[model samples]
Target: MTKLLVTGAAGQLGRAVLNHLLETSKVSPGDIVAASRDTSKLADLAAKGVETRKADFTDEAGLAAAFAGIDRVLIISTDDLATPGNRLKQHKTAVAAATKAGVKHILYTSMPNPDKSLVSFAPDHLGTEEAIKATGIAYTILRNAWYDDNYLMSMPHNLETGTWYTAYGAGKVSNISRDDCARAAAAALANPPAGSTTLTLTGSESLNAEEIAALVSKASGKQLNVVHVTDEQLAGGLTSAGLPDFLVKMLVSADANIRAGNFDLVTSDFEKLTGSKPQPLSGYLANNKDALLSAH
Candidate 1:
């Protein structure tokens, strides 16, 4: 039995991947290890007989110990991307540890079109990809596109205000559900192909900002208008709305990418991996209607 370990197992995506591996793939709990900074958060998984280990990205000794006796490992990208170079440092540490541990196969969660993306943190992911390549480990790089669930944050405000602020203009985004991304990751881990590979997991369809707003309007039965603005204007508005400076910059950069058609690519890689169709934006909105409607 291959000992599969998933880092950041306490996080949203990480938990989803582990659950899919167990419930969907029907893998034995004893064969999987859940590694997180706080193992207490993974008590439920521990109760299920899945091993839980504490591993801090900044602590090399702890990572080495946690990675021991693991045949395959998945390094979910850290969430602290706001501080420049902090995330890259964490990823490098993990990659080095995995290589040193002689792990047969390594997986990484990455953003789509990182090399050419305009998103502020794209460089960090691209650099991590380079580091993984340098290690010469059999690798699987999953370039996940934007998650439709992210809209829950901005959509609530847009719905309440009756105005959808965006800089995307007519540019479309192939936004995949985070759940689907996790499922694909689980599938890859369950049956990794020989040698290294790169896959871009994207939504089934490309929808522009206006079309997305239309979906929200249909779901909520409210009148919402897409108010196109310049990236500078959008950043200014978000900053005025009390958003952190780093987040404001990140959102503006993502909009700039959308406007430049950087996120417009729609691919079948997700279906090819999971053997199922990716959920459409409308369906996602409908499923989470109540939560979105009541989000403060």
Candidate 2:
């Protein structure tokens, strides 16, 4: 049995991937290793007979030790975006540690069109991809689309206010659920391809901001008017709304990326990896109607 390791196993995506590995892919629990900075958070996984290790991206030597004897490893992108270039450095460290550990296969969770994406963090992903490829190890890079669940962060407030502000003028985005991304990641890690490949995992359909607002309105029985704004105006609004400087910049850049049609893409890679169609955005909204309506 191949010993598989999943970094950041305490995070939402990491936990989801581990769940899919055990329940969907039916990988033996003993063959799976869950690594996180705080191993205490992974006590549940440890109870399931999955080996748990302390793997901190900032500590390259520690990571190599944690990756010992692991054949394949999934490096979930770190959320160290507060400082510019810190995230990329963390990723490069992980890649180097994996290479040193002699890991046969490596998997990564990335964003779509990183090469030309306007998102502030695109460079981090692109640099990490280059580093992984530089190692000459068999790799699977899953360029995941924006998560439909991300809207939940601000959608409820928008629904209550009956106004949706966006700068993505007529630009469409194929939003896949985080769960689907996890499923695809698990499948790729469990039964990796024979060689290196980069796959963009996306939803079955793409929808623009107006279409998205309409779907949310219909799902929540609320009147949502899409208010188009300039990037500067959006940034000003976010800043006034008490968002941090880094997040404001990141969100604005994401909208600009969408407006440039970078995220306007659909692919069957998710289905190809998981053998099932990704859940539609419309269905997701409908299923989470109560949460959408009550989210503040």
lDDT of each: 0.92, 0.95
Structure candidate 2, residue pairs in collision: none
> Quick one: how many clashes does candidate 1 have?
0
Model 1, span 35-105: residue lDDT tens: 99999999999999999999899988779889999999999999996799999999999998998788889
| Each prediction's number of clashing residue pairs | 0, 0
Compared with the true structure, the alpha-carbon lDDT of candidate 1 equals 0.92
Compared with the true structure, what per-residue lDDT tens digits does model 2 show for residues 65-154?
999999999999999999999999999999999999999999999999999999999999999999999999999999999999989988
Give me the candidate number with maximum lDDT. 2
RMSD over all Cα atoms, model 2: 0.7
For model 2, the stretches where C-alpha displacement exceeds 4 angstroms are: none
The reply for model 1, stretches above 4 Å from the true place, is none
**Positional deviation of 256 in candidate 1, in angstroms?**
0.6
